[model samples]
Structure formats: C-alpha cells, structure tokens
Target: MRWKHPVLGEFSNETLIHMAEQNGLIFEVGHFVLHQALKAANDWLAVCPTFCIAINVSSVQLKNSGFVEQIRDLLALYRFPAHQLELEITESGLIVDEPTASDILNRLHILGVTLSLDDFGTGYASFQYLKKFPFDGIKIDKSFMEQIEHSESDQEIVRSMLHVAKKLNLNVVVEGIESTQQEQFILEQGCDVGQGFLYGKPMPSEVFTLKLESHAQA
Candidate 1:
C-alpha cells in the first residue's frame, strides 16, 4: 500500500493541497495542501451546503501569521456547524515550534473546529505533552495496529494508549485495521473507533456511499 504521508521537502503548498484533495485518501493531504483546500471551498460553501472535510495541518501551517483568522473566515463562510469540520495535526507538530503551534491550535479550538492529534504514538509520547494541547481525539497510528498480531510490545502500547485516553476523556481511533481480529482486539481494548481494510479499503466517495447503503439494509 502506498501509505499516505507528506514528502517532507518536495511539495509546495499549492501543489500539495491540489494533489491531496483531488487524488489521495481521506488523510494524506499535506498541511499546506489542506490549507489551500479550505480556501478553495469558500466559493463552494456559498453555493451548496455539505459535510465537513477533515484536513491535515502541518506545523508550518500553524506557525503562519493570520492562520487562525484564515480558519475563522472559512468557518464563517460555511453554514454547517463548527464540529462538522475537523483538523488533523500530526503529533510531531505539537512540539515543533511549541508556543506558535499551541497558540494557533488554541485559536482554532476557540473557533470550535474539532481537533485531532494524528499519528499519536509516533511522536513524543510524554505525559506532559499530552496534557498540553486541547485535542478532541487521538488517531492511533497503523504501525501499532500492524504489530498487534505478533508483538507483545505493540499490544501493550495499544492497551496503554487506550487506558490513558479513557482517563483523559478523549476519543481514540485505531487506524489501518485490516482484520476481524484487529477490530475485535480494539473493541476488547475499549477503543471507540477504528478504520482499516477489514471494513473496506479506501474507495471513491460514490462507491463508499453504495457500500454504506448496502450494509445499512443488510
């Protein structure tokens, strides 16, 4: 599988967002690309109402001047509720430029868009850092899920994460789940949500809707 992640160095803000919004799965759009995607949606919001689209925001995007204002403008443009839209920020971005990142995130929280810490365990997993931000949810990375079958360490990691999230009152999403065993394991661990090939590999929105309808009536 071509795991979705930013190239780190090659993409410009425009190119990255265009590629992500047009072709990638739900979560791979680079932060720069997502920023532009929101900007692009302003006109659409004026024409027709729709569900919120989750966008990935980078540390660089957070550090930009007027970032919060830009987000506020976009939110205001849409007639939908604030919770309809969500912004996924990588765990590493939280501490990259600590104060700036925090300020920008805090501002967004005030604006009322849901915030999620993406790829949770992949970054600095300190208790202090977890307490620092206002994240509505944590996306358990696929690496940990992939290890659940054979690795004791992975099992412990998932359990530990679920434990902490419960204590903190946060929603947990286990990503990259590809088996019934994985889904059952996550449920056994008390995780709230999960997504993976076991449910269905990522497909176009129309196909996904058809699958949803079939399952709903099944």
Candidate 2:
C-alpha cells in the first residue's frame, strides 16, 4: 500500500490506509489486498511448503456479511490450506459490532483458519475482546519494547500480559524485538516467538526467497 506523489514524494502505508478508511474505501482496498496476499502465499508455498502467511483484516471487511464466504472461495481458488492462512484482527476491529465480529470470527475458526489479536494492549477493550473472541494467539504491541530493558514497569506489564495469555492457553508473540537484550528478556519470560528488526527488515518476495534458499542449503 505504498504510494508516491510528485509533490509529496511518498506516503507511508499506514497513512494511505488511513486515507482509504476515511474515504470509506477500506472494504474495497482490504479485499484487493487479501486476494493479492492469498495469491502470493500460494506462490510462496510452492517453494517452501512449510511457510505460512498472516494477513491483517480491516474492520470494514469484517462487517461485511460475505467476508467469510470470500475467504472460503479464495482459499479454494488458491488450493491453500485454511490452517496455513492466518487472519489477524486488532481490538479496535472487534469493537465495532462485536456480535457480528464474533459470529464471523467463530465461523472462520470452525473453518480452520487461524485467528490472532494484533496490537494486544493498545486498544481500550483488550481483555474484554480477548474473552469474547476466539483468538489462537495475541501479538503484544511493539510499543512495549521501547524501554523494556530499562523500565521495570514496562517489564512487569509485559510479564502480566504473558501470564494472562498463559492462563488462557494462548500463543504469545512479542513484536519489535530489536536487540539481544530485548530478545533475551522476553525469552527468559517464556515467550518463544518474536518479530522485529533483529530477524530482518521487510524485503521483496524474491529477496526473501533467496534468503530461504540460502538457509535451506546451509
């Protein structure tokens, strides 16, 4: 979702997405992105059968009654396994029309599609949504990592999140792990999965494929 203008130079993905949302075009944009993502995932799986792709779902898309059916048709079209496609929704996405969101989420769950609550603590009703939604996991927001190594309160907050997630039997993923210290702290706290610059920055599909091939050969 990157865009450049002659006068403005370039716009961030988030800014473009925000503009789309404000213009009431998020549903159309989200659908297109979902389709393209599924196609990309299908292509990637041909190279690495174990690879799984996670896509973010917009609140507008969730509100649409045909959302679940669209996903079903796309998975069938791509011949991709439902379990290999993970749909991530934020707390804010679930807040608008909770019942509708819950129903759609439940159906997706039954269809074997993995669901995750993204940006776990940033929303106002995080815990409430967690209790109501059928999420396979939660991604602790990247903001938590900003000063985690030096801030006791931040560390305690993350520990609390991990503790609650453990009680719910949910997989926990901490985002924005940029250093060995941050990674070690989360690892010591029993978080086994993380995503950040420590691993790699965003790259083109070809670049990622090359890296994968190199790793496989090694």
Candidate 3:
C-alpha cells in the first residue's frame, strides 16, 4: 500500500490520515476527510452508539465558512450531543492565522463542541493566546515527559502549564504518558483527564466499547 499523503506531497496521506480514519482512530483528518467521516459516523450511530470520537481540525478548515455549516449539518443528521465530539487544533494552528482561528473557534464554542489545543508547547504563541481563545482543554505534549526527573526546565514547564490550566479553570490532559511514573505524576498533579498508551492504545469501535464497558463495571 502506498502510504503517502496525496495532498501535501511531503507526507504519505495514507499513513497520515487514511489509515487512522479507516481504523476509527482519533488522529488528524483534514477538511475533506472529516466531512466524509461525519457521514460515516451518522450511519454507525444507528447500530453502535457508545463511542465518543475526536477529530483534528486544521487551520485551513477553520478559515473556511463551510466548516461550521458542515458541523451543524452533521450534528443534525447524527443527532449526537456536541460534547460527544471533540475538535482538536494544534497550538500552531492558532497562531498561523490569528484572526481566522479566533473567529472559527468562537463559532465552534457557540456550537458547543469541545475545543482542544493539541501539542501545547510546540507553538509560538505564549500563555497570552490561551486567554485570547476559548479553548475547552489543553493537551500537554508527550515530549515533556522525557528526562523529567533531572530536567528542571521540563518539570517547571509542566508545572507551569498545570498551574495555568488550573487558574483558567480549563481541563488539562497529559498525552504520551508511556510510563507508570508519568501516569502517577499527572494524577498527582490533579490533571482532570489523560490519554496515553499506558492506559490503552487507540483501537477500533468494538475494542474501545469493550474497554469502556469494562471500566464502568470495574
């Protein structure tokens, strides 16, 4: 299988987007792919209704007027609450085109869909942008978890992020928590939510559902 992104030319679109979508994993899907996925989700809801899925929203999608319309139409068709769907945009996406990003995110907030800032520290915008935009949560990048024990800078950054989120009253989710120590630290920090391989890898609908059911029962 050719695993290149057909659009960007730099990356295999297949490995980048298609494989994730086909497997029902929560990864980046551009405007075109997201529209199709919404349609599929609507169809899936009829039979399997337990999974709450998230999709990445790129900067280009935000600037387009049709994006919000697409979301509204899909919600009407699927009849799922906005909370069940998450729209993730990279922190860099916010700064690349500020005005458009602000407008688009505001509209999405009005629509009641969850907005998450992915890869929090990788972007140029500082903590100021966090206050400027209406984000529901922030995802701390996995890179921070590296050498956390001896690296005062890394630890301080994480602590600062946690402090900022707490003051802002926004949710914090630490991603890429691959080790037990990382998991324990996040929990100790009183982070509201988390996602990492330490908990479970992304799986198909059936497997995801089973895991959720198990957790509820436990």
Candidate 4:
C-alpha cells in the first residue's frame, strides 16, 4: 500500500499500516487489499490460467472470525480460481492466536487456496511455525541472500533452510536475487523460484499485463 502525503509526497504504507494496527483498522485495510488484489487479478489475468497472485496477510486479519468466508465470497464474486490465489502469511503474523490462525489456514487450504509462509527465517520461531502451520511453501527472507556469495555461514543457513523445507515437502522461493552469482547459487541449492531486481523491478499492472502478453506470444 502507498500513501499520498501532503508534505512527504507519495510513500509506502509501513507507517500507515502500523497506525492502522494500533487503531484496530487493520482488519478493514487487509480485507480491502485482498478484495482489490483479487479483483485486479481477475480483471487482468482472467485468460491466463497459469498465473497466480500472492497477497500478504496480517495477523489481525487472520484472527477475524469472518476472514475465511470473506475470501470464499470474494473468489466466488470475482469468479477467480481458488488455487491461483496464494495468501502469503508472515511467521510473526501467525504467532498471534495460533489456534485461530491454524483453523483459518486449514479452512483456506480446504478451499484450494495456496498458503505460503512469507519472509521465512527472519522471525524468532520460524521452525516452530513450520511445525504448527499447514503451509504449502515458504519464501526465504532477503537477509540470507545479502552475503551469500562470500559468507560460508550464510550459505550453510540457506542450505539448511532449503533442506528443511525440502524434507517438509514445501516449495522454497528465495528473495533478493540480484546478481547472476546469487541466482546460480540458489539454483544449485535446489531453489526453483526467486524474486528480485535481477529479474525486474516492480511495475504497474498495465505494464505487467503487457509483459505477460508478450511472453505468451513468444
């Protein structure tokens, strides 16, 4: 989310999201984000059956009693495929109300929506989260990639993470993959998916759609 500030111009919503959390407004904000994301994906990628859209989910939104139903209703309303919509939840987000979060996640899984544990390895109880939650995959945090080329410890850490994820049968996606060396290293480590500046920076929806169309034609 981005905010248009009168003094600071446009900025990302990190501060705004903190405020929303403090004010008990994150639930509404989270739902709005999900709704808009699903709507946009449905509108732009309706014909692209292989495309999957991932949305970050918050703890406050997860604990809400109606969260799962909201997702179901939205998918039906948009006529979007449940399996093509991935909800990325952070370890910190799942820390609060574990039982509730687990229940909600289970329900979402039942609906055929993919669930990914986002920013893996940064949180305090990352391993515990893996044991508790029913996650289909994990996105390794970018911190591990920063010094992966030179640091043996970082390399071991990533290898360990990949090993654990593999043992759990979870798909692993490495983040912050900029240089070819970094990409090659993760690829060698058996990470099949990655996202970073190396591939492409963030772009508008129209530009993304055009790229997809071009790729389809190619």
TM-scores for every candidate against the unseen true structure: 0.73, 0.93, 0.77, 0.93
Model 1: clashing residue pairs? Answer: 17-33
Residues 1-218, candidate 1: write the lDDT tens digits.
12344665454443554455456432434434445555544434443355355676766566676777766765665444577678888866666688988888888888898988888888756456668888888888898988788899999988998899899988788999898888989988877589777777644445645665565558
Residue-level lDDT tens digits of model 4 in 1-218:
56678998866555666778899999888888888888889876654777889887877888888999999999999999998999989876787788899999999999999999988999998888888878899999999999999999999999999999999999889999999999999989888899899998766677888888788788
Span of ten consecutive residues with least summed lDDT in model 4 = 10-19
Whichever of 1 and 2 has more lDDT, that candidate is: 2
Question: Would you list the C-alpha lDDT of every candidate in the order shown?
Answer: 0.70, 0.88, 0.72, 0.87
RMSD per model, one decimal = 6.6, 1.7, 5.8, 1.7
Q: Which stretches of candidate 2 lie over 4 Å from their true place?
A: 4-10
**Top candidate, metric lDDT:** 2
Query: How well is each residue in 44-76 modelled by candidate 3, as lDDT tens digits?
Result: 555556645677775556666667777877787
TM-score of candidate 3 relative to the true fold: 0.77
Candidate number that wins on TM-score, 1 or 3: 3
- Those runs of model 1 whose alpha carbons end farther than 4 Å from true positions after fitting are 1-52, 206-218
> Which rank order by lDDT, best down to worst?
2, 4, 3, 1
Quality of model 1 by C-alpha lDDT? 0.70
